[model samples]
Target: MTERTVGLMVVAIMCVLILSRGMALAAPPLPPVPADYADKHMPDGWWTDPKVLAEGEKVYMGQVHPKVNCSNCHGKDGQPKKKGARDLRDPSLVNRFSDSFWFWRVKEGVPKTKMPAWKQYLNDEQMWAAIAFEHSFSHKGQAADHAHDEIQK
Candidate 1:
């Protein structure tokens, strides 16, 4: 209505906008990911697969046949903070490699990591089956291969 009133209102709105923009820019987000990565891609029918995920649930709950329960350290919910435990919900690592890579990791084991070789405890079928279950926890596919070496290899 009045020039002074309009100017004051404009100034107040500008200040509010400036403060909000500053605060938004100042707040740091937790855990960063690469620009090319899709942080979360959990799919449906994850728990429906009796062969992999359902059996993986059994392994997570410690009722799996052939034993070697994963729950002892990784926790029943697939969430663990222990030294060797991995963030099963994170697709970046869970979906890092192909099914074969997962099989190799389970059988041959991850070097220097807490992951132990399961070749002694589980057979190939069981291992791949477990990986299939892991898919329930991981994204559909691997992240973009940013490096030429990775693409070549």
Candidate 2:
């Protein structure tokens, strides 16, 4: 009700805003894509290819190969279908991993996890295509957190 009270309230609000901004600035940046994990040569324009994307979509949907059914765990829209499955739609995580990382993980699979190695059932190209599909949900282009130089090579 008083001018002095209003001024004090404004100052408190300003202090909170300034502190939040500082905290955001103090946060560490996302790590770069690992050098060894970068792809040697990604299929040219494969990420943009309709047919390839279609195949990748099929792989995501578990249509092409029974073992390649990502949606069974990751959900159709990148949400986790089960309790431990990660929400793939999280850009903070998805954008941090390079194409090669995705490919390697798909090929080798994660240890002590539900994810199984898909290399035995699918060839390299199909795996790459599937990565493209997974990345499609949250790719941020060149400015994305992960380095995909190998994917373009």
Candidate 3:
């Protein structure tokens, strides 16, 4: 190709990147981490605890007492609502990080992602329990798009 063509292509690519960066920058920044972040669970220990898993499901599935609502964003059957959220039914992330890291991230929330920290919503026990529940979703055999079942069922 001619040098001019190559230069134009480079400029076009750069413009796309710049536009994308500008779009991302336009969104408001996420909330800062809460002050009480220390002493949370380690990510490795999460999968092994049955109590935490049970409790996590109770909250994640709204089966627990007082019935907190995770079903609004993440689907009731453990699917995420929109594109960017993790599909809890998918397990490519299992054992990907320490169990406590999962707990902390869940408790602390991922900045720039829709995943909210359950810290304010749930206590520590409930937080770890939610982690266990999320891990359990990764072990499932659900169809790719759970929304199909929702409409039919």
The deviation in Å at residue 53 for candidate 3 is: 3.3
Per-residue lDDT tens digits for candidate 3, residues 39-91, read 44434555556665666667876666354667667776568887676666655
User: Which structure among the candidates has the greatest TM-score?
Assistant: 2
Select the stronger candidate by TM-score from 2 and 3.
Answer: 2
Ranking by lDDT: 2, 3, 1
lDDT per residue as tens, model 1, 1-153:
999999999999999999999998872432323232223222334334554565655654556555576666665545675777776666555544444445555666667787778778776556655655555554432222212222111
Residue 145: error of model 1 in Å? 19
Better of 1 and 2 by TM-score: 2
Candidate 2, which ten residues in sequence have the lowest lDDT sum?
141-150
lDDT-better candidate, 1 vs 2: 2
- Candidate 2: stretches off by over 4 Å: 1-41, 139-153
- Model 3 bad stretches (over 4 Å): 1-51, 63-68, 141-153
Report lDDT (Cα) of residue 6, candidate 3: 100
